[model samples]
Target: MKKLFTSYLDTFKGLSKEIWWLALITLVNRAGAMVIPFLSLYLRDDLGFSLSSVGWVMTCFGFGSLFGSWLGGILSDKLGYYKTILLSLIATGIGFLGLQFITSFWAVCLGFFALITVADMSRPAFFVALSAYSKPENKTRSLTLIRLAINLGFSAGPALGGIIIASIGYYGLFLADGITCILAGFLLIQTLNPKKAKEVDQEQLVENPLAPHKDGLYVIFLIALALFGVVFVQYFSTVPVYYKEVRLLTESQIGLLLGMNGLMIFVFEMPLIAYMERRGWNLIGNVIGGLLLTGLSFLFFYIEGWPGVLVLGMATATLGEMVAFPFGNAFALRRAKLGRQGAYMGLYSMSFSLAHIFGHNSGMQLVNSLGYNLTWAIMGLITLLALALLFYVKRRANTLKI
Candidate 1:
């Protein structure tokens, strides 16, 4: 028994110190991820935003995220990963402080847009840092490690956010969230210190955006990914709001239901992925299957007559999330040569960034106009279209030969 435990531990043993530090930073920052999970709810419950307005207002975050994704990649390459991470964190912390004071709708929307843009710049820079420290073969696992850290933190954030709002109000949550970001950035900077200064001050800095490579696999994947993202992202945006409105679940209940994704991922994903790889699981197959399951997950909302429909639906969605993301990151990086990782990671982040605009806005609009089940059914269909695209790309997956 002890040998088995030790062996499992060994699987995570060899990587870089940098990878571990990045995961630590992820844990600290994401532990305070109290804002976004509650953003839609805040708009609706506090400011009395109609569902349509909620959707449109959330569009600001998406637009900001799009620019943030681009900037994260670019700055990580040009200015260095450390500086990019530092600037993103400290700047976003200020944004959150600004958010605490906004009361009106347009003001709230603009605040969210600006805040998300600044905060999201951390994503690709974090990815670039991960790739720098990961061995080629372990890249997917490396990505999964940071994601695991994120999930572990998320497992706490929603539940904690629920408590904070109950005790201290949304204002407290925002201030807490802002403080953690600054703290995480500070800790990360101090830990890496002068050694991390290499990217900016040394030979590794990219002076120009590298041109896109041949065969356009990167571009194709990005387009297909955006489609899948439009479906996948509903868990964060539409799910809580829908359940709260229609199902009449309380904030704590909604948080737990949402946080279930985190708990399951934290416990199960690494071991499960390890087992699958040993059995020769195809990455693209997982991607396609995950997308299919994501669509199907929404169908549970139709089965409201059953007791566990919502929980079951969320369970299915979490599984889809687990399989898709790390593999997607891996696929994105698989085609890139050594130095261009920042560019690839940046563009990959952009896929979801763009999806946020389409998904949140269209999803809430559908909910307001067409109703939840119909909106979900439409999303399921879109997922199938995305699956078809992935299937096409899978056949030529090896063509990326970079």
Candidate 2:
């Protein structure tokens, strides 16, 4: 145990102070991520929208995310990540504060679209900032540290959100979300002085940087990423509803169950990533394994009636997430050319946005029509398809030597 603890600590060494500050800002912003986890529930129960309507609203959210990601990348490159991040956080905060006022279905859809567009604009900027802060040698670990902060906040957020929902109601959640985003913006201003920090030399990182759009192999990787995201995002989108309606779990129980994913990642992901990095494992192989595990996680839903299945599935999915996300992010970052990091990261973020666009609505529609078991089966099949594309990407990368 002592040796294991030491290894975990070792994983955190050598990351920049700026990365820590970035992680802190991420933690603060994500801790109020109470809204997304419970958005479907709020739409259905509080606003009295149909499940179909909820799905449509989520689809709009995805579109907004896609646009935001693209814009953020452009802005990061032009305005600098520091300014772009501040703009996103402050604007998103105000957007969230106004979101609660929209009650009608179409208005809610528009509200979410606008809100998410402003909110997700930070994602690419955040990635660019992270790349600027971290050294080449420690890039993966730095990514993991930021992810750790995100998961830790997610772990706390849902639990606290459940309590808030029980007491003051969903309005409280909106308030918390809005306030925290603004707070994070202010904190970033106070903490990270981009002018003073010694940025990693980009010229040394990539000798010949390829534009993300022009790179065929990277595009294939992005396709696979989108598919993986489709399966993975179900946890945030449809799985909560599944827990409540099918598994007969209460809000608090569901929150705890979802929180388990974050807690597990927080406890185990860093050391696991460190061990893999030390072994010099192939990034593509790690991602494939993670996607396979994630696919199998959904299959566990087949064993219905027992609440234990939910726990088991969450554990499997969390493990898959831990394995895939950091490495996948690292791969994207490494693949980026020095000058075009924003474009690369923007496209990467955009892939997940595509997943969000399709995944939520499709899962909900499947559940509404075909039943939960069939929906889980379909998600597994989708992952299989993603895996196939990834294999092709691996082959192409070898052929092109990218």
Looking at candidate 2, the ten consecutive residues that score lowest on lDDT are: 200-209
Clashing pairs in 2: none
Worst 10 residues of 1 by lDDT: 197-206
TM accuracy, model 1? 0.93
Per-prediction TM-score: 0.93, 0.97
Residue 181 of model 2 has an lDDT of 96
Candidate 2 C-alpha RMSD relative to the actual structure: 1.4
Highest lDDT: which candidate? 2
Which pairs clash in model 1? none
lDDT of 2 by residue, 79-181 (tens): 9999999999999889888888889989998999989888888999999899888888888999999999999999999999999999999999999999999
- Candidate 2: regions farther than 4 A off: 205-209
lDDT of 1 by residue, 63-151 (tens): 98999998898898898778899899899877887788998888988888889989989888888777677777677777888889999
